[model samples]
Target: MDIAAIKEQLPIREVLQHYNLYPDKQNRLRCPFHDDSTPSLQVYYKTQTAYCFSSNCATHGKSMDVIDFIMYLEKCSKHEAIEKAKTLIGGDNQLQRLTRQAVLTKMFSYFKNAVYNSKPAQEYLQARCIDYRQTEVGYNAGQFHHGTRKDEALIKSCIEHGLLNDVGNKSRTGDTAYNVFGKWCIVFALKDSSNHVSGLYFRSTLNNQDQRHFYLKDRSGLYPKYPATDTKKLILTESIIDAATLLQIPAIASQYSVLALYGTNGFTQEHQAAIQSLTQLEEIIFWLNADQPGAEATSKHAIALQSLYTKARISCVKMPQGEDINSMAQAHDNMDVFIDLLEQRTADFSFSIEKENNNAGEQQEKAKLFIERGAPKQPTKTPPPITTGELDSTNPYKLRYERDTVNYYIQGGLPKTTDNMKIMLVIEDKASTQKARNRIDLYEDKQVEKLCKEAGEKLSLPAATLQADLYRLTDLLEQLIEKQLQQARPPEQALPVLTAKEREALQQFASKPKLIKRLNELLGKAGIVGEERNRIFLLIIAISHKTADTLHALIQG
Candidate 1:
């Protein structure tokens, strides 16, 4: 609101302090835009702007107002700087509001006409990667109703609307009206959701000027000035120029609607209301500048959208660091960069509050399911306590535990079990490291007992301990052998044998190349392979045929 008034009234010192920047007794501070060794920025209270004398600084020898300083410090757009300026200026209505639609239209038309006349302004827009012809943008030469019969009335109205200023003297056209936007500025028509022009946004063509961004007194409205009622997807950008930049890309403009925020803190009540009205909205993606403030804003707005529109998919497209859409578009002449980055949007927990909530809900649901189903059984039983000996080639398996009679073994670094079909018994001297290993066959109990006795005598261990160990080993071997036999030869039922004629018919059916190819394809889809797959194919064909006699099949391993 009243951007000119704010710049005049708001002191540069106050703006500095708001950002926690303090100037010494000399009213100087280190330049924040670049690496500075000392305070090179000098504050001029008379002009209410700060200038850095450091040649290495980006703002070297340039006077920056409250808005410009904010833009540089926040690494945001000019529109964002204006929004930040509003906060520093305290309240809205610093000047009278421009409510006359007729006058606003005339003003917009004048600026729109100026774009065609000025080649430099056109080049500036083109350099910024903005399509002024397609998108509703203009060049403000700061000439409002020059040399017209209605000059006095127009000047008075423009002054009241903060579009013109009274220089306290009559001009060549006999009016005290001085255009506030000045010469060489790009004009953008900021429109409401209903496609009505609500305000005007100005960006200076002069790079040397610090206060390059300016908005109409009442900075309220979205860019593009169109109905978003049918838009299923929406793109939110940080600046109007960035939104305009997206509008130039046919791919983006055709499918998604772009809404520009003034700054990181620029999401207004009007923006919220406009978005809420989009009943058909399926997704909302932020294409803000790739800076710290932009990142923070993207997350903040994404969370807000999640809370407000739970069904809408909220996400953000990360640009190159410190680059915005317009700058990136300008760098790369093609739209593929935008499309590629759009495909890689981050809308998960970082951006979406609903995603976080859903994750928590999913975890709770999993816990509930576990309770209802009963806790899952452990894949293996708890292992026995073991004191393992050093690995050796002779005894590959480690000792699990040393009982009074014998030592148990852990086979293959895992818990000893009957499934592995490997077991060992170690008989060792209680006083020394000497030990004896006895390997026995599961079927030969007496032979294993004889070997155990001989090994025990070699180690000088008690005969009774060796005998007890032999008994224990025999029982374990018996169970393991039984388990192996059961696994290797599972129970089977008797099958009827097919007649010679039926078998001949099945063999004939399985010989077709087309059928075999189709069968292989199906088997491939089911992840079946090798010789077993061929057997299954034959089996399928055998079962599909109408056979009067029962079928007997033999498969090779």
Candidate 2:
């Protein structure tokens, strides 16, 4: 885990709220570390930091961020505090249950009753050729109530889950606490691999075209709820209506399992996890819309599915232009067209092979052109991606930043990202030809120090030099990180040129008695004066703001 990133993203306000402490209107709160008559701790929201001014406080005058505050409140170490912060931020992979199971069961039951009673909802389902009789579905009349006094726990759970909205309002009891889904909307239960309802998805039956679909907050579920492990074929669709249509068809429903994505870009991690559990799966057919977005999604999802299930045949059925499965089904009134489309289904492998062949032909043409230009044709040797100075060099303890390792021989040198900087630390005893290996994170000082100490006792090199070289290598890594951030910026722009008047104004400002005067003195000693010096001074100031704090400034100007 990157502790720095956690500290950066977790807010101090969240930490205080977690502890049941609220800050007053002035953003001042009583310091919990010591007894106080009034609010004394100041919360700096901009910096996500808090400090207590009360002298009697144990944490007085200490700038406590979320992580530091967690440590103090939990009475735990920094590492423990960081782990707790991760849980609080929901950063880790553990899937958090958003609502209670009982509440959802009761809510689904209510919605089911609403579905059965509403004539418009049944007609809407019939119009779409959706046979939801065998499947779990619901309808929202926008009049859901969380029950009476005996079910207070369930009511509170409903409120927390957002199934019951606008509580404690002045509206009548029947008018209050409406579900997010407005009147005449169909609700579908989405489930995890274990067949447990994890979330709710809704389709608006109203005439609001812009707001046709809605899902519960933090929706983390997939439609159809479950696919048996023995199922060998899986068909993926773009929407629940399309999937439901296919499921209503006896031929497709018996032969294959149908799953629907929320939309083009709505393939969640939960969907991937569910697919991964299908050990018997052999084919994944993307039956999305025939539009550009659907085509793009098919290619994208096919590639991802290919990576996950390499042996599974990845194919796509091309629908008629601008027509999805539901529309096609509605137009044909049968499965004949769909069956023909399935028969004409194209495999992604053919496209991939054709692409590679075209690329190869293009490369050959380029090579022919190069030869025709009289450029010397010679076989070139490529370096083995990475090299270690400590391993291959005669000076085993060489302090080369780019290719250096201290006492440890890295298998993959260093990770490019700071989050994955853990490396395998290997040391060898030349006398016995024996080796010792341990994995350690370079960012963790304690781990590096321990590795160095062990290496010193095991190898002929000194531990201090080894530790110093590792530190120096990390410094170079900071410099090397520009390559990672370079792509994040647009094409670099040329330095802005200052006008004569602007230059004169800058010079006059820098010549005044302050920190800027030091820059002016340095430029004066170099005998560089006028517009060029002003540009250099401005450039120095701009760059220094990125790396230096208020107390420190780069004095190169």
- Cα lDDT tens digits, model 2, 359-443, are 4465222111001113444686764544644223222112122333333344323344555455444565545555566666668
Against the reference, the lDDT scores of all candidates come to 0.67, 0.67
Alpha-carbon TM-score of each model against the true structure: 0.45, 0.44
**Model 1, span 205-283: residue lDDT tens:** 9885578788888676777664368879899889988888888788878888888888889888888988888899988
Best by TM-score: 1
Off by over 4 Å in 2: 1-99, 146-151, 172-182, 348-557
How much does each candidate deviate from the true structure in C-alpha RMSD? 28.7, 26.0
Q: Count the backbone clashes (under 3 Å) in each candidate.
A: 0, 0
